[model samples]
Target: MKRTLLAASLALLTGSAFAGTTLDLGYKAHTSSTKDDNGGAYDQPFVKITHFNKADWGTLLAYLKLENPGEIADAQHGKDGKLTVKNLMIIDKQIGDSAYNWWLQNFLVSNRTVMEDNLYLGLTTNRKFDKLFINAGAGLNYSAAHFDPTGASFDGISGGAVVINAIYPMQAFNLKHRLSVNYEGQFARDDEHKSTLGYDSYGHQIITTLKTSLTDTVYTKLHLTHFDSWGSSPNDGIEYGVAIGFNF
Candidate 1:
């Protein structure tokens, strides 16, 4: 299923250098099949707003995300790792048609009224060749968790995927489409109240999307995302969603 989706998406990037600003709002519902028995089929609704435009100074881009958990068995499922919001800021410099972008992101996750914040910094260089576009970059992240007990907290530092993304836009099967893929593997360290919980953690994710314009201002996207986190503790992932969006 994953490979089929990826191949179909790549088929869209044939020969293009068109760029524009886009905004997306959507939700995904999936069944979880992790090693842990604590998992359940959950429908997560998300609202995302993104802005990207070319400016005299550079190309500026920004995004805001909000996620809601519809149901849960555990409070962690109900309220844990719930109530999350993230924001990203990006600046890009163009040389010819290709560009280099630097970005920073802030993430907040709330569980049972306890909130945690994480920050990440990243840099990427991208090139557009005819109908194919590629991007690569690496980033570092730091996370701080706050607890209500007044004396318990967790902190962590991690390096995230220096990844490559290839996109192909509109040109096959009489349907306009766009396909994108990316990967990441990183090492992490965690400390609680300055005490080591573990010194090993790693994560990886892959997402493939297919999009077509229904009209001049409206588009639809079929996306499938799979993620894995393995090491001392692991978080396996699942996501599949069909989203309809409007573009300006």
Candidate 2:
């Protein structure tokens, strides 16, 4: 079932790529501070691809992130350093001429041993005033986790979250700049175990991105992100990176 889902996702991406697509490659380094003050840092390389049709069918986006490449980690998880791979897919459809839009997104994360998947469905609204643009969205998120080890009592766990995102964009120094904020409150109740996971948990993230033209088809990007979480799972992190990209 997992293989079939992956294949279908790849097919959709391939079909969209044949239309008009933009690709971005970048690297980022981040550090996390856990509740116990045991902090660690890692480097990540990421790729983003976006595609849209001229007939306004919708937009498709694919993003992949690799963490701790080359095994350069500041800390370790058990005997090995932390390493993770994550992929995100998003689809957006407009609601006629109104300011509303519908979106569906999926996220998959793996740590070579365990895998977690999340699905989200939401609605968004956009408003533009002069050179400034604002977008806000609310969504429902469902997540499941799988463990690789056999004989584990935790066959699978499921959870849900209320997710919100907002974006503000403007021109600065003749460059494109944007600030984005996201929040998620998650909860889960397991009947078999008579327990709850991520109960009363919440996370907030803030990101700022600046882009400037390096050439007619090339651009330079600077980005900074801060994340915080609390409740059953408490963690905080920050990431800063710069990348050079081109449009085709």
Candidate 3:
């Protein structure tokens, strides 16, 4: 099922109907510290690819993330670790000439042993005031979890979230940069196994990116991201990462 979905997404991405397309490849290294482990830090490295398209009516996006590509095993190998593969698909459609839009998003997370899937349907709005851009959304989410290795099954749960994002562009030190802030809060029923599972989560992140144009079709981006998440036992952490992106 996962492979079929991936194939379908790629097929759509390669279709010629889209008016514009952008592809970005990036590498990021992250370290996370948790509260329970005496603030032990875990290292995670990710390779990501993002495909964005502008269609006649709206926009489509597909993102793929591979965490710990080197498969480094240490203290962060199990419940406290990150997923090995994460895939996201998003569609945004404009509502006439209004400032509001409709969006559908799906996410699949897997570690070759366990998998989690989430679907979101929502409304979003984006506005620009002078040099600042603000975007916000509210959504409903349906999530499911599965353990492939053990063939364990669990009931799916429903949730909701509110998300906000802001971006500001600036010129300083003879360079152009963008600062972005994002916050999201998800509320869901506590899982049946509350001691071992968590569903409600909140995250906040700030990113600073420096963009440099290398050519007409190529560009470089260096960015630093600081992120924090809470509301779930053993799932709360602070993470920081640096990444470099190449756009074509």
Model 2 gets an lDDT of 0.53
lDDT of 3 by residue, 1-248 (tens): 21212222233333223422334455554433453532323556677777766555666778888876766534344545544888988787868866677978888877755566767789988677776767688898776666665566555555575667666666566644555566655665335422223333444344555554344344456666554433212344544455555543
Per-residue lDDT for 1-248 in model 2, tens only?
21111122233333322334445677776654432432334455656554433235555667666666555554435445556777878666778866677977787777755565667778866555443445556667665655455312232433444555544444577655444455544445234211222222455556677665544456667787765542112256677787766555
Please tell me which predicted candidate would have the highest TM-score against the true structure: 3
Clashing pairs in 3: none
User: Which ten residues in a row are the worst by lDDT in model 1?
Assistant: 1-10
Query: TM-score per candidate, in order?
Result: 0.68, 0.65, 0.70
Question: How many clashing pairs does model 2 include?
Answer: 0
Write down the lDDT of every candidate, Cα atoms only.
0.55, 0.53, 0.57
* Rank by lDDT (best first): 3, 1, 2
* Poorest stretch of ten by lDDT in candidate 2: 1-10
Off by over 4 Å in 1: 1-25, 35-41, 69-83, 93-116, 146-152, 190-200, 230-234
Residue pairs that clash (backbone atoms under 3 angstroms), model 2 = none
Regions more than 4 Å wrong, model 3: 1-32, 35-41, 72-83, 147-152, 193-196, 200-234
Task: Evaluate residue 154 in candidate 1 and report its C-alpha lDDT on the 0 to 100 scale.
Answer: 73
Clashes per candidate, residues 3 or more apart or on different chains: 7, 0, 0
RMSD of each: 6.7, 8.2, 7.6
